[model samples]
Target chain A: MNPERMYDALDRITRVRGVRGAMVVSAEDGLVVGEAVMEGVRGNAVAALAASLAARLGRAAGAAEAGAQRFVHLQAEVGAMLLMPGADGLVIVAVTDQHVNVGLVRLEMQRMVEDIA
Target chain B: MKARVVEPWLLAPVERFVRESGARLTMVMTPSGQVLAQYGFTRAVDVMSAAALGAGIAASTGEIVRMLDEPDFRVLNHQSAQHGIFLGRFDSRRGPLLGLVVYGEDTSIGLVQLFFEDFVADLEEAAPAETPRGPVLAADFERDLNESLATLFR
Candidate 1:
């Protein structure tokens, strides 16, 4: 996808209430394709961690005889991470607060993935 | 892969970096091409050759940056179809150190760079106080080089 479109998608996701950042990252290499992050958010670090986690989850799914992972949600004390795997080894990641609307974020992320594919 | 370091303090940080980054090959050296630690090298000759080339590249690039009147780049990366090479510089109590890494398709530059930041911090924290050393004579240079190589490979 074009850079403009990618940024637009990330912007839309980050506009969600409680979302700290959104990024398009490469699942294989953990590099940021594009991002819309708030100040103090380390985009590269988030991309790396999200990609690594998605890759490991993909492996675990394969081992369990499950199909490719469509979505992943990781919850922590203060924040949460949501990932949506897309085609061409790309993944969409959202860093959000604990109170963020997970359903809304997931819906937008799915739309972004579909747009990429 | 096991990491060998000429300085005992380097062993822990280098080994941790190799394990976390999944780098196929790594070499930690000074700007003057003196090897401090290395991993994934079987031959002494290869280690010397790589150290020389890595230091040369850093020097030439640094000069180029000076000519352009730009700030020195923190890291240099060369990505190919099959592998990627990363060379980064970090400061420690001893002096500036250079880390050269070669990684394959299994790992990405982002991951390597991410772990590299931690590695540099660990090294900086672990580095001992620098000791004064006499200048190397032409005759002793080769001997010192060979001894360092022996320590790394052994």
Candidate 2:
């Protein structure tokens, strides 16, 4: 995958309305391979959290129907965590305002995932 | 072959079940935001986007209550005069969260949870043996719902 281009795409995405920042992480390692955002947003924490969340969601759940999870979203009153798959060993992370146009954000994030993949 | 490619086969049935359950939108996701599949509403505003928002809530909530011995999730079910939003956690290959939104007042919480549980079981049992072939995208699984949602909301 083109790391540099991915960073550019993330920067552009996070710049959209209500987006605070974005990160590109290695889902397997929980490592913050790249990040772009405002102050106070911990890139590492986001990466680790995303990785952990991915692991928890991707590993195995008894109730999970017979299929792979397409994506996971954790919503908070303050903000939201947006996780989308990247190429092997990677995931796209976005922290956005609760009121942001979620549809637009999702489309952009999905577009980015496709581009990176 | 990219084993993880997202495809419609993984999403169609889930969508049908969600709509049949009376939810305006239903999203099957990983705990982190990877979308397993979705049903109901297709527009950009459909469940796929909402799952992104909801999954974040589940994770943050899961972290805070883990101290209290809650099992890694905070199911948020809010009911009022107008609408209801029910959130719960489900584990597949990876344990993901499921969110269901009822547009109008539909207080059958028991039914909602049961429906979710049933689908989760089906997903686990029916999971494709070979890893999917392609980098999975949320849209691939959410196409019908996205279209439906757009039509409804518009």
Candidate 3:
């Protein structure tokens, strides 16, 4: 998938009421897909870390007798991380603060996942 | 045998904490698409009814990740101009998530985090006998996959 398209989606998520920044990355190689990140926030580190987390979760779920993992999320003290598997080898990530509505975020992401897939 | 079932008692208390703190909603979902429990404001639609919605959210928008020393702690907090949310991993200690959501008006996020720690403790203290049932088993999933494989084999 095009990084530009992913970035556009990230930008929308960041624009949501309480989001601080948003990013998209390739979880396969830990590469930055597109980033509209904040200064204090390390966008690359976030990408790599998100990729790693997604990879682990993916592996764990695949190994489970159940099925594959749909996605992975990590939350910090002030901000949060959202990782979404994309078409081919990409993953989408969003970093936001506490004001984001979990329901809205989920709805929006489900739409994005369909787009990426 | 199925793994021991998990109780969602944490939903009531955590929801109370989030609503009392003015948070719009709170939810906990497994890495997979299983939504364990959710409390707070939700649309009448069934979208908010499922548990894996959290994983769906995470996969949709990849973002900030903080690795805590304690295991089983995956938290995602996002803020919109009008609302705010904090979603985290189920606190293994408390048998549910140590999550708290606050919305409307600018809140002291730092202070809310402090309260999260306390809320976690409270959940642990109020641990119930069983957690909610995990995600559903898609009975047709394996059959579908097998059918696809059979076509390729032919």
The number of the candidate with the highest DockQ is 1
- DockQ each candidate and list the results: 0.72, 0.01, 0.02
User: Which RMSD does model 1 reach against the true structure?
Assistant: 1.9
Once fitted onto the true fold, the runs of candidate 3 whose alpha carbons sit more than 4 angstroms away are B1-154
Task: For candidate 3, write residues B1-154 as lDDT tens digits.
Answer: 0111124455555655564344445544345433344454343233233334555555443333323333333556766677656555544542443333545443323334444555666766776555466443677544543342333223
Off by over 4 Å in 1: B133-137
lDDT of 2 by residue, A1-117 (tens): 788888878877887899998888877546677889789887766676577677667755425764665677789988898888777878888898888777777788888888888
Q: In angstroms, how far off is A49's CA in candidate 2?
A: 39
- What TM-score against the true fold does each predicted structure earn? 0.92, 0.42, 0.41
The alpha-carbon lDDT assigned to residue A69 of candidate 1 equals: 96
Clash pairs detected, candidate 1: none
The window of 10 residues in a row where model 1 chain B has the poorest summed lDDT is: B133-142
Tell me the lDDT of model 1 at B72: 74
Give the alpha carbon lDDT tens digit for every residue of B49-95 in model 2: 67677877887878888878867674677766776677777665543
User: How far is B113's C-alpha from truth in model 1 (Å)?
Assistant: 0.3
| lDDT per residue (tens digit) for residues B4-64 in model 1 | 8898999999999989888999999988888999999999999999999999999999899
| TM-score (chain A only) of candidate 2 | 0.90
User: Tens digit of lDDT per residue, candidate 1, span A1-117?
Assistant: 878878888888998999999999988879999899999999999999899889889899999999989999999999999999998889999999999999999999988987777
